[model samples]
Target: MDFEYLLQLILNGLFVGSFYGLVALGYSMVYGIIKLLNFAHGDIYMLGAFSGYTLLTIGAGVIGGQASIAVLVVIMLIAMVLTGTVGLILERVAYRPLRGAPRLSVLITAVGASFALEYGIAVSFGPNPRVYPVRLGNEAFTIFGARLTYAQLAMMLIAVALMIGLDQAVRRTRSGRAMRAISQDPKACLLMGINVDSVITRTFFIGSALAGAAGVMSGAYYGKIDFLMGFIIGLKAFTAAVIGGIGNLRGAVLGAIVLGLLESFGTAWLGSEWRDVFAFGFLILFLTVRPTGLLGERVTERV
Candidate 1:
């Protein structure tokens, strides 16, 4: 590929990867805390985009065309908070009661939750895709002959900031330390007086919040939102979480960027239609070679 084309592909990969990483954070965090795969995660992401769109439309109407950019930011914050709350409710209603049930049962529950959220959204929002208003400007910046829009840059920045903030929280705060403890040994942590349930719930909140933010960002950048938007991206994000190491937060982010780059290059070299195949091909290769993932710790097989 030409240098300019290479640069452009890299930029696109980073832009898309950031959102993948953001969504994957939820997967990684939930798995770390409870070891249950929240299959409805992608649906939650789709819901977030709808929530953002709704809030933005309402803001636009209430504030009129002359509203300042700050007003939009406030609306987005509200949307994120609302979406995060929904995520918490999902965990409570759909998953919590089944804790420690057969893995197969939980998996079925996850699938059911996924379908419920998707169809529920379809019923409520209709099957049609909605367009997100152009709240962010369309200024392009050139770097190394690669052009990037302001919205892309903003999405990247926000994703990075959230990741960094989460890193600090997990590594520094007392609540974060408790969360880590529970991840390492939920039974032991519960014995030690750490509220295991609360920690797990909080993990979901944080992770889902990140996914919600990504939803809004994706909607703004792509100018479209639909019930199925999360399906492919959610699968990709899960692949990213597994590739990086499901329980490792930083690994999730790193894996997402790598997957994004691989997909971008694959699409450029092969064809867009082969993107999903290429992704799954890599996933299978990694599973065969290193099932624990790139950064996942090796666990001793129990008898």
Candidate 2:
């Protein structure tokens, strides 16, 4: 491939990786606190995208229309809040009661939840895909011979900002300390007067909010949203979290970029149909070589 094509692939990888990373955060956070896969996370992501679309429709007073940046911002924020709230509710209703249940039961419940969410969305929004209006004008500029779009840039910026903020929150804020306490030892956190349940809920809020933001960005960038938009992306994001070291925040981001770049180059070479094959192949290879992941810490479970 030419240098320009390589650059373009790299840019594409970064843009796509950002979205993967955002979704992965939800998986990682849930895993860290609860050790449950929350298989319905993908469905939660789908809900976020649809929520964003709905918000845009209402905000513009039309199905889709050009809106000012401020208006779009409000719509996006509302969508995120609504989606995040839904996530909290999902955890409480679907997962919370099964907290200490068998892993298989939780997994099954997650699968059921996923199907219910997807179908519910379909029934409400119709089975057809909907186009998202370009709140940000569609414009492309070449950087170092690589074509880059404003939507892609905005997606990257939002993803990076959220990632950085999440990192800082975990490392610095009081809530972060509470979260870390819960992740490390929920029983101890409770003994120490920390609200373990509240921390977990907040974690869900942040993670789902990130996913919601990603939904808005994805819809805007791809110019489309559908009931199943989150399935493939959610699965890939799980791969990213596993590859980067599940429960490790930074590892999730790193894994996402690596996976995205690999998929981008793979699509360029092998064809788009083989992208998932390449990603899963990479995941298997990585697991075989380093099951703990690049940045994942070794932990011993006490029986």
Candidate 3:
């Protein structure tokens, strides 16, 4: 095996893994706060892609040219806001009502919500893949004999920046403190006059916004938008979250990057068809052995 090829695979893995990390962050955050496994979260990402597609198409009609980076950024932000609002609405309309309900019932509702988002988009956009109006052209440069595209570089950088910003927000900000506190004890937080519901809504918004940004970036990078795109990535992101420790933010990122690298190497060894199998197989192994995850701390719940 060629060393250069191996290096290339590693680079590609990191690039894709960054996206998994972003999506997993949402899963981890929601789970950490409410212990809810939001099946619709992935579809929210698909919505963001469609949102970006719609905005860019409109922008193209007005400008009569490929959207500038600035316009693209604006489109991404708009998509994030739109998706974030959708997440907030989902919490209020669906999850909020079922808060104290059995976990299984809530899980079922999440599945229903996921299906609703999926078919709703299908009905609106038609059951066909839509090409993105703005494509980040494949302009390549070499780094240490590994070929890298300008678009991939930008996506990686943006993803890293967002992850760093999120880390800081969770660590340093008042809202972050509230999130942590609520995660620890919602009843205690409420007793202290903290609005638990509001904080949860905001958490959903922020997490969904991150997923939205990821979707827009993905659409630009891949140049196609489809309603079902998020389904597989959602599973992978969930796996990443589990591998990194479900409720740990940094753990999700670490798991995603590791999963990406494992997939890359696995594909190189076995073939592309075995990639998912390899990932899921690893997930099973991890569950059987180290279920707490690489960075996950074992929490004892009071009976």
Candidate 4:
């Protein structure tokens, strides 16, 4: 009911939603291309955060503890490359061989892969939450009684820019064309001389890269990273993908924004404990009412 508070929540929702969109894009892309859920996608995000954390920690000694803008950018880029490579390998090792297997089998494999990544990191990192060496200090500016941090603005800008870049790539690039073609009919694409496998592999890489970027930004923003942190967020991202229309790039972003706003307002109304309930409730409602989502068409769709 308070207008200023409502505006603040909106800004927060958009910021949160942008990151969700990043992760959800990975889900939607893999699903759209190979029809694999790639539940392990979230774990790749976890790894991204860890990768950045590790790099930053190594640089901490050199940078004297506080990471500058240049250092953070370099670390984020490195983490994205690492995470993208991991996604590429994951597709080859875990999902590619089972490409023709039953949907249930692939689904099970995805879940298994998810578990493997989650606990593997736990084992390696000892399961304790790692404090990110990179920190965006709490400098902020208020707008009409709503406080917005410069860090938040910078992060949101980067996320949105990445999302826009992806949308453009999907729309205007040769690889994007290949991806869409493969998505529609891989068999036909194979017949038409398109390398389906390559396209799908690249999809995973790009999606995972975006997710990795999100993970780094999130770690920097929130100031903590952990192995299992990706699990719930992964589920939420999937919900966003489904809500946005799995194969539709813009839809995924839109869905995430919707989910973020819903959670922001729902938490405002109900409480933090009820946040997940409200978020997932939208998933169920959308599934029952409009399975294809706001932008998904009944006709064959492309990623």
Candidate 5:
């Protein structure tokens, strides 16, 4: 391929990968703390997009014309808060009660929760896709012969900012320390006077909030929202988290970028039809060859 074509592919990969990373962060965080896959997590992203669409639709009636950046930011924050609450409720209702039950039970509950969210939205919103009220304009600028859009740039920057903020929160704060402690040994943390339940709830909140933010950005960029939109993205995010070492935060981001690039290049070589196949194939290969993931440390299980 030519330099410009290659550059465009790279940019596309980065743009899509940023959102994947955001969604993957939620997967990694929840699994790290509770060891639950939380299959419904992607629906939380779908809900977020819907939530942002609702808020913006209301705002459009009041403000009229194109929305200002401040208004869009406000809508995004509202969506994050709304989705985060939904995630908290999901954990409390679906997962927490089964904490001491068999892992298989919890896993099944996760699938059930996913179905509930998907069909619930379908029933409430109808099966038709809704157009996002505000579409971020695809005003393009050329960078080294590769076309770049303002919307894509904005989404990428926002995703990066959120990822960095999450990384800092997990590494720098007292809550971060509590989270780490609980992940290492929940019972020991409780014995040490740490509020394990509260920390876990906070983790869900943060992770879901990130997913929500990604949802809104995606809606704006893509200009359409549907109940089923999260299914593929969710699976892709899970693959990313697994590739990065399921419980590793930074690894999720790295794996997402790598996966995105792979998809971009794969689509260029094969067709778009093979994108999912390519991504899943990599997941299987990674599982077989380096299950610990690129950044994950290998651990020996004790009998």
Candidate 6:
């Protein structure tokens, strides 16, 4: 095997893994806070991509049909806000009322919400894949014969930055403290004057926003947006969370990177057609073995 080709695959894995990590953060956060699997979370990411598509379409004329990184950033911010609001509203409408209900009921409700979001977009968007307005050029540079696109590099930097910022905020901020406290014990947090429901609402919002930003970034990079696009990535992200130990923020990221590499190597070994098969097979095997995951289920570090 050529060493340069191996390095290229690694780079590709990291790129895709970063996207998985962003979406996985949402899954981990929601699970950490409320122990909800939040099946609808993936559709929130789909919403973000569509929202960015809408904004880009509307603003394209205003910007004279030219899109720059700055323009994409603005669109991404707007999409995040939109998706965050959707998450907050979803929490209020779908999940909050069932707070004390049976876990199975809540899980069913989550599945219902996922279907609602998916078909809602399909009905609105005509079930057709929408092409994004912005498409990054394939301009690239090479290091030791491993190619790196300017767009990939920029997007990776942004993803890493967002991940780091979230980690810092969770560790250092007042809201972060409240989140951790509520995660530990909602009743105790309420006793301590921490608004448990409020923190949870904010958690859903922030987590959804991260997923949204990822959606927009991915849409811009790939140049296509479809209603069902989130389904596979969502599963992969969940696998990543499970692999790294769900509810552990850093663990989710680490798991995503590892999964990415696994997929990359698996694809090379078995071809693209067998890639998903290989990855999902590994997931089943991993769960049957070490269910606690790489970092273990972390209580204090869940956020």
Per-candidate TM-scores read: 0.94, 0.94, 0.97, 0.97, 0.97, 0.96
Extract clashing residue pairs from model 5.
Answer: none
Summing lDDT over every window of 10 consecutive residues in candidate 2, give the lowest-scoring window. Answer: 61-70
lDDT of 2: 0.84
lDDT of 5 by residue, 55-127 (tens): 8887788966566556777888999999999999999999999987887899999999999999999998899
Model 3, 296: alpha-carbon shift in Å? 0.9
The CA-based lDDT of model 3 is what?
0.91
lDDT of 5 at 137: 72
Model 5 scores a C-alpha lDDT of 0.90
RMSD of each: 1.9, 1.8, 1.2, 1.8, 1.3, 2.3
Residue 68 in model 3: shift from native, Å? 3.6
Candidate 6 global lDDT: 0.89
Best by lDDT: 3
Give the whole-model CA lDDT for all candidates, comma-separated.
0.83, 0.84, 0.91, 0.89, 0.90, 0.89
Model 3 Cα RMSD, Å?
1.2
lDDT of 3 by residue, 117-191 (tens): 999999999999999988886779998789999878888888899899999999999999999998889999999
- What does candidate 6's lDDT look like per residue over 1-303, in tens digits? 899999999999999899999999999889878988899988999999999999988888886554777888888999999999999999999999999788789999999999999999999998989988878778899989999998899888988998999999999999998887776788889899888988999999999999999999999999999999888888888888888888788988998999989999899988999988977887887688877679865335232
For candidate 4, list the clashing residue pairs, or say none.
none
| Model 5 vs truth, CA RMSD | 1.3
lDDT of 1 by residue, 196-278 (tens): 88877788788888888888777766788899998988899889988998878998999899999999999998999999999
Runs off by more than 4 Å, candidate 4: 299-303
Which parts of model 6 have CA positions greater than 4 angstroms off? Answer: 64-66, 298-303
Worst 10 residues of 5 by lDDT: 294-303
Better of 5 and 6 by lDDT: 5
The residue ranges of model 5 lying beyond 4 angstroms of the native Cα positions read 299-303
